[model samples]
Target: MTSPLANPLNRRLLGASALALVLSASGQAFAQTTPQTDETDDATTQLSLGKIVVSAGVEKIATDTPQAVTVLNQDDIDDTQASTIGDLLDDVPGVYTAGGASNLGQTFNIRGMTSNRGEVLMLVDGVENYFEGYRMGAFFSEPELYKRVEVLRGPSSSTLYGSGALAGVINFTTKDASDFLTGDDRFALRTRFGYESNGDGKLGSIIMATRPTEDVDLLIALNGRTSDDYEDGNGDVVTPSDASANSVLAKARYYIGGDRKHSVWASAQVWESDSYQLYDQITGFTAFGTVRRRTRDEAFAVGYDNSFEGNDLLDLKAQVSVSETLTDQDGIALASSLGYASEYSYSTVQARLENTSKFTLSPDWTAFVTAGLQYYSQERRNPRYKADGSPLSNGATTHPEGDTTRYGGFVQAEILWRDKLVITPGLRIDHTELSPGAGVVVGGGSTAVPEDATNTGYSPKLAVLYNLTDYLNVFGSVAHTERMPILDEVYSRSGTAPVNLNLDPEKSDNYELGASLTLRGLATSSDRLNAKLTAFNNTVENLITSASATSGYFINVGEAKYEGFEVEAEYATRSLFARASYATVDATNETTGVLLNTRPADELNLNLGYVLNSLDLTVGWRGEFVSGITNYNATTGAVSSTVDSYNVHDLYATWRPRSGSLAGMDVRVSVDNVLDDYVKNNLASFAGQGRSFKLSLGKTF
Candidate 1:
């Protein structure tokens, strides 16, 4: 008889478990046994306006940072009742989702730049999530698995995050055992079940956490979901949209050294999905048939963090991670006994190390410096198979079997003057090399030799913030960023072999100005108001764009420009809260004097909520609006289409008992698209979901 772990999938799980054990053992051997104080606890206890560690320079309070940043806590995540990444980001200003309904093709558009070609960088716990190939998606993880999400807008992030962040960065921080074991309990368990009417979706999740000792903690979670095809506003079923997904996550942490100054952690997550998409048959081609698609994604990471007790100069953090995404497509011709299959795989491995130091320049002035190094590599491969499970001799992969390697180093400094003024400056340099494999075939049925290219980039950023009063601050920033061409842009084949090996790196100059105000006791003794306004101008040179619709090659567009403004405000009291945000962008191709394709339209979001503490009940309402947008023709550079503007509304309520037989239990209900309004996204090809209701129940012990 064989053990259950003997199976391949179980073996992988056991391997991840063993790796966590090894990390724990190593931390215990190198660290001194002492009671550890969790830094996250201290951070959580601070007011919302306190220091933020996700900024460009050293950690600083929100009022001191010169960029537009948004932080969403767990409570915000729960209130939205989101089923996909797009749903989760709908309310964020200056950001838009491009794909329709499916998780496999979704991408983000930030400011006037988009991630369709990997302009925006996605990070999970400081580890890079690489996207490659045409059908690839962003890092999609279960919302319940995260504690918070931080979005940094603009190109200044290049100094800290390196390449692929020409637009900005989105970072996700996962939950830990301490998040669930809030009290003195040694063990805790949480279970959740939810349903959505639009897709007839049902979901179940379980989380378990344990603190075996004062210095060790462990957490494990599993989630599963299944959904059917959903209906549009017109009461028509969205074809081939059914799906089933599952995710597994495990994390471990060990605290070592005196006063818990040293810490080590390891985390592993695996997500898999099976879904179908409709492919209409060609008018004259009998072999064309509907296709079925399946996708699987997995990510794993390990990290170490340490802080010195007696010294303020040597805090260290390091991480290494690897991720892979695989997609398979099968097509069967309904009119004949014919079938075909193809597979695509993308993978990445990355590592990072950083050290931070702080010094007291004077009684009222302090300074900090951060320096880091990063390295990563990515590879993509595609293979085609015949209906009889045999290989096609003439078949060729898309984008080539190539890999990209990047190495970078950066340093940033933050200085305070008289505790009323702050200045931040940073610089980064990166070297990248792209190597393609041999035996590649071009579109014209000719073999092309592989080519290698190397490029370098320099990024510089400076920002300043001045406190005008106790409740008001003004800030400004200017930065220069450069992006090297990605694999697909340079290696994608055209007729016979027109490889672009001499393409120059795209360059951008960005400028921003913003202000923030925090007012306490605005109307009542406990009322608070926070507001922010920001404006930006960005110009890009040597923009890489496709040459023509018929040509697969890429060329450098002369220039492009993006200008935008954003406004956000929130007012909160003991029992009531209200918030609103608006963003507008004007983007154009400078050389052609025409609007960019699929440019994001003006957006507005508003929310209001009230809590009845006495009854343990809460109710809220949310609204979103997007203006009409114009689309441009790729070859003719003319207006080809327009998407009409639309509006959506949602309502939600929650009941949780603080102290009773139902204590530690919560029930939530929501109605989305309350009016059953017909709506279409500015960039998506399909219509948005119609009126729907959601219900969720959860309990913790």
Candidate 2:
């Protein structure tokens, strides 16, 4: 069967081609008017024209990185007024979050790759966020706690972030005391209250910062939210959807010396949620029950950063962190006297040390080498029992207790010539070991025991970037990445299914080509345009696939291929802003010659905003479109489900005083799904939220 993207005249193709043409033209025009220079400061000035992303293995501007990346800063976050991380990421091209409106059971998909036993990695403040069971996927947190969010698309990140980052990485950075307090200010406080109509939810938060001394700063924040069951687009209440969540964050920073060249910081966050769960509406599970679910996520980290004052060549950073997640489910059957409970927990401890050394070989040549060592250990435990406080006779665990340890070392070099061309080459070696706990009894009989496995992988990456001009750049990258089979993929079982400890690691070779163009002073004096076009192709060997939804056993699918492209553009002025993004992906199984059912057909986003400067007000409109998709059931071998195309619109307005007595006060109002569209997600499992309204008020002192 022919794929939709195979058609040359497809809108996604045309849009990408048009963007590429514009980039080429802009590059030529800018190149003709400027001459290349060797001053290192000039390169820094050019790259600092936009936000810098530190997660790209180095601190550099997004346009200068040889990969596709998306960054949302504080201003962008405030404009959207989102409550959840999923909501903030909904409009990003090539990104999708499953599970509809609920935060639990949510999964993330990048390009055409979904989570096959943890392919995408999530990080908070550079520490890993781990999950154990297959049913519960990604982590969820309130958006107010984050100061910035960065997403890296593709397997290129595997060189720096091991195993789980085979698809990509998403990092969230929280706020600091210095962000709110001025030089002389000793304390700062901010508070917010919000309400949403669909779920009748209420949100409240308070953030406090204090500087006890010139060398010490502390920050603390608390957020709470509660909501009833929300209605779908058809005005039907989704059962077991009521939820309540609370989160707290604390951080402290201390300067080690008077010069402040050496600094140490500590931070911690705790988030807890209580919700109700029911069998998926489409699953046809006749067993009805009232399930009380609770989840707790905690993270803590300490880090030190130092740039040797006497040694101009060395910069060092070291960090250690621990994170844990626990989930419990308690339920009672409606028709039967049966009752049940289950608990799953996962924890990770990690440490990293890195050093960067710079060298000036000659006037036109300079180089920097970064080397790092990382170590992490993961542990998971799952237990099930009856409501009568007795262990299940079957003794079969949902997810058995397991432990995994990973150690890795990597080095990368960046070499630049005349500040116009840059090349980076890197390599990483990782060793992983997995150990499964004792066997469990099932149906009064012993189940199959799990075996231990150890694996080693070598990843290599090469990237090149050429500056066509200060405002336009073209880049390409090729990487070979490997992912070891996770504990769930290797040891999970159902009934008598044997553990799959013999499974081989999944490996992929990824290639990417892209261009970035920035045009300042386009028409108006304050108008600027930023655009990006990226194309990628990846092939996987020994792809891991689930044998059945009910059975936890997995099998290798031999080989598969994925190809995709994304286009994004944003135009902004002092008072007006507009943005558009589009993406398309194609994935196929080589042996069966069938398309993979992991990705949506296509996605597009459009947003426009205007600022009434005199009145301190801003108004915006946003629209999103997702093409229809078809999904096949691996177990049934049939077209099990289909989802129709959907379009949603949102309108929002915000007012913030810039001066006078109301100076730090803000008020916002927003309406989502203005058309009341009856939209279903690509998975065809849950309907989208109906038309909803939100109002917020905040003040800072």
Candidate 3:
């Protein structure tokens, strides 16, 4: 399945985005001044074969990439100065935030789509970081350790990656020891402490270093924390006693640079994502306590990328990896006096390669084409059946088995038509195999076979940039994307149909047209002001939605359409900076003709920051107004679960002492749910966290 780009809603994202860009500009301008570079960092950013890369976001490359991408750098992390994975995600437009009720597992939503359903992909270095629970969030890695975050938004990304890119990709790049390591005996450390209105206390520290001739680079980091249940303005306890945890991360990198351009490196990690919610209901605030989960995950691999100069100039890279995760979920419904428990074990092995060359077709144009293939396989298990935290017994015990296989290849090419115009078009094709174990009845019951299916999908994307002038660009794009049904979807088939496949691939088209304007900073600004306007129309085919109310089986309703606009603007100067974004979505279900459930129609984000040599403080807040929504019963024509509009806020600050050698060291703090809004998040899923605060310290040597 392939979707076309939204020609109408493209304007919406561009328009709403302006609100964020404006605040970001001013925020940076007021923060601090260093070198005369494209960034606000103390170190200058350079361009070369592989000059130190800024993954947070690569500007010209971001604009030139065939897909729509966003970047949030370490500075952005520091400015917002967040403590949890959920806090950093605010920079991403169209993404839904979760896990606020507890610091356990926060889920992210993209384009009104869910993550951890294997819909979105999260990669750290080269390993997948996200796992499944009731909710989804980043792996147990410290955000302060990151250098940058790149978000590739959309299924058109499937060609580059396989299974999970259905909603696009989030590539998290970690800071290399050498990038910050200094002196023959390198060493650096950071410590932090914080307090919250909910009686939450946090303390942590990290230490890193390397040995010159020992052929070993070592890093050690840890985070220890504690928190209590919080009461919102409405006077209700959100999840409390979110099990405090002690986490540690270690790494070792060896140098094999005998071949100069030829080198190989590998790393491994084992971490825990655990949480215990003391309260049951956060929506209206529940009295049910004692909810918990624990996930032990480990990923380790070795890969090599070698470059060779030949007639065609080929750069070859390949890697094979084995990763596994074990998750234990436990919950007790106080009212029902029911305790439910289940576990899932997953292991995956994958390999991939790519070859690319730049061709000098003509004096006025250049072309680069890339081709690659990736394979992924996994085994999953689910033993008990439950609905809305309630036990459901039919045939008694249920053990479901499932595995996935994906083989795909894609090629992207760019044509530079003179110095001002560029065009990029890419296409990918994939073949997938989905197989699940048959179901058996408990204690000598009947046995039934589960159906399996194979599918082939294609994704294509195109982006054009026409530079009206040196500082302005007008661009347009159209693309198609798709994703096969995931493991859970196949296991939970509806109505016991004698079907080969339970559902069709979800397909969508995002069309866009937008413009960017760069203006000179007004004050003693060493930076530039940016303004963007975009309108877009997003159409999804075979939109699949499930419900637990009626043994919620996955079903395809009909076509769904979402149209919107976004505006983003920013101003960066030496003394002050500001950035802001605003988005309005008009989403509708064409068949039933009702507002899409949980799809917010209006959203706004704002951030303002200022840096006073010894102290760099920032205040930021985001507001989302979920318009009224109703669920329609296909046969009865009855509407259920009506929701109202609401808003949320957050505040952050950082302090750096100028007098001591601790120049690069600073303290950062943040408070989420400032107003303590008691907004019912997902009625079927769970509630959100109450007002909470976190503090962290960072240093560079």
Candidate 4:
């Protein structure tokens, strides 16, 4: 008989078990030795779960919100040391990365919804940000630029976000000068440096914040990243993996008006990446060859906010913004044969105005109502050039140029009946117009004369929450939303196929129910636990099919349904803490009885940490377990293949001196994939990164 310690699998299992047992024993031992009282260490509390969410058109605690949501703050961002945006969000339930593992290749997948299909919406500082291209990710930005990230799951958010939000919304808020200004300090400077061993990656960032006047603050940030090719768990090098990026952020805020209740702000951001990589960023190795690709994203926004303290019916907020995203590719190795060097870009101008009113009806009843109007104009252009740098008379029909303008208005009311019951109702309506760009041509070399299209969409939702007990609560919601057809789907043509001008809007009906449990001093006098379980089912009609080289575009066919459940729990004490998130999602194409390819396998993430208050240090262990998934052909209902399940573990530590000469210094170290497991997610085209040792140092002045 072989010794269990001699087997690699057994070794990993033993490691995991040992870690869990050590954490449990330590926690119990600490509880026994430490003083048992009603008071607990403030630093040991779970702050992530108590975060406030604003993406739902109002401010509510994560546990108090009726819908499913997640919030990651600055501390969480720094601890992850994520290289790509995907890595930063992988721990969230019902959220994962799809496409590839590269910085420019990864995209977000929520439930079974993908950004490529226009199901997901993303925002940076309340400004829309997105780009869609063949085999390319939709949103790209540096993770270091943000101080907070909020994820709102499900289509129920469509009422406030927009009518086409089939998947969910992701909001990123950048750091502000006020965030760094401590006490009466008028200026602050922060610098950070980081390194990763696996890919030999390096990061350098710096920020300067200042209060130039009594009522004005300004901030500027610059960040740069560079990384070389990395090897997989099997010691295979993924080619064309080298990448680099640089970005800048600048913003300012000024307070005006009596009592300083009014304020105005402006911000500008730019992110650019230039790399020589494969044309199809989604796949590492492809026969399409490589190109010199440069991608840039620019955004500018100005806004005004007024609290109107004494006025019950006058709280206003307004904003205007412009954003542009461009991806230019040239020097294509196969351009001579393919006859195309592409330039894809999207330009958008948007404005919004909103107001909130509060009313007190009786001592037990109070209501808050919010209404808003939004307008945006967007243009998508994809131009092609020959190998000699000459413009082509007719561009590729797979991606047609078009303009879209939308006007929308929405109203939502939140009514509270004491602290026991809450009701929320919302409605949104949008009108959109689409027009084809100049020099449009079809696949057969004929000048295409496509007709303009106009459409209207509506979203309605209702949600209720009831506190059955002080320690337990139940919530439920129902929503219906309509998604208008995108330019690519309605205007794209191929082979002998013509433009699809009659594509109907996609409609989604969503239902969600959940419960939460709050427990204090369960095992020890100072321990706390907060847990939530959510179950959701969504049905989408008029699912659009993508066009092929020989097929026309935007054909609305059958229905697609998705059902899932999520569990989020946190436990903490003075010296020990544990957090876990588990998700199970299943989706199918009702028309063909085939599982949706975008569906991810059930996953569970566990994290446990121990704090050494005397040393100002915290150490933690994390384990991620994913289940196997079976793939099937959409049309034929044939088994394609299966992805095997895998488990990966990580170890991390952080130290920040509070009362010493190094008080302003912060240090972090992490060992990712401690076992070097060859992990593969169902939505990914490549295996996950191999074992890596990461370290970072930051200091404030």
Clashes of each: 1, 0, 72, 0
Q: What is the lDDT of residue 200 in candidate 2?
A: 92
Per-candidate TM equals: 0.88, 0.91, 0.80, 0.92
Model 1 lDDT per residue over 1-701, tens place? 12332233453344344334433433443322222112243212212333264745665555456887777776667766677767777888888877546554467889867776667777778777766544444455667777777778888787899754667887888888888886568999999899999989888989999999888889999988888888877788875556678888899999996476689999998878877654321111223534676777788888999887678999999999888888787774541222277676778898999998998988888888899999988877766668777864222433466778999999988888885798889899989998875445444344656568899998999988987766667999999988889877777665644657777889989999987765554455545555667788999899898663233466687988898777776656668877777777778889988888746777777788888879989898998766666778755787788767777889999998999789989899999989887777766656778899999999998
lDDT of 3 by residue, 126-209 (tens): 455544443334344556556677776655555566544555677777655555566555565545444444545454556565
Better of 1 and 3 by TM-score: 1
Give all candidates' CA lDDT scores: 0.73, 0.75, 0.56, 0.81
lDDT of 3 at 450: 55
Cα TM-score of candidate 3: 0.80
Which of candidates 1 and 3 reaches a greater lDDT? 1
C-alpha displacement of 337 in model 3, angstroms? Answer: 13
Candidate 3 C-alpha RMSD relative to the actual structure = 6.9
Error of 4 at 214 (Å): 1.3
lDDT for each residue of candidate 2 in 1-701, tens digit (9 for 90 to 100): 12333343575665766586666656555533332222132122212125678888658767778888888777667666676677777877788776535665456778877643456777788776756443444576778899888888988787777654667888889989988898699999999899989989898999999999989989999999888888887899876667688999999999887887789999999889988765332232336645676888888999999988787578999999998888787774631222277676778899999888888889998888888999989887666677676765321344557788999998888888996988989888989998886553221123545568788887899999998777778999999888888776676666555557677888888999998777655555445566788899988898987663333366677788889888887766677877778888888787776778776668778888888889988899998876777777654447877666777899999999999999989999999999888777674345767899999899989
lDDT of 2 at 383: 65
Model 1 ranges off by over 4 Å: 1-57, 278-290, 332-339, 393-398, 441-448, 548-552
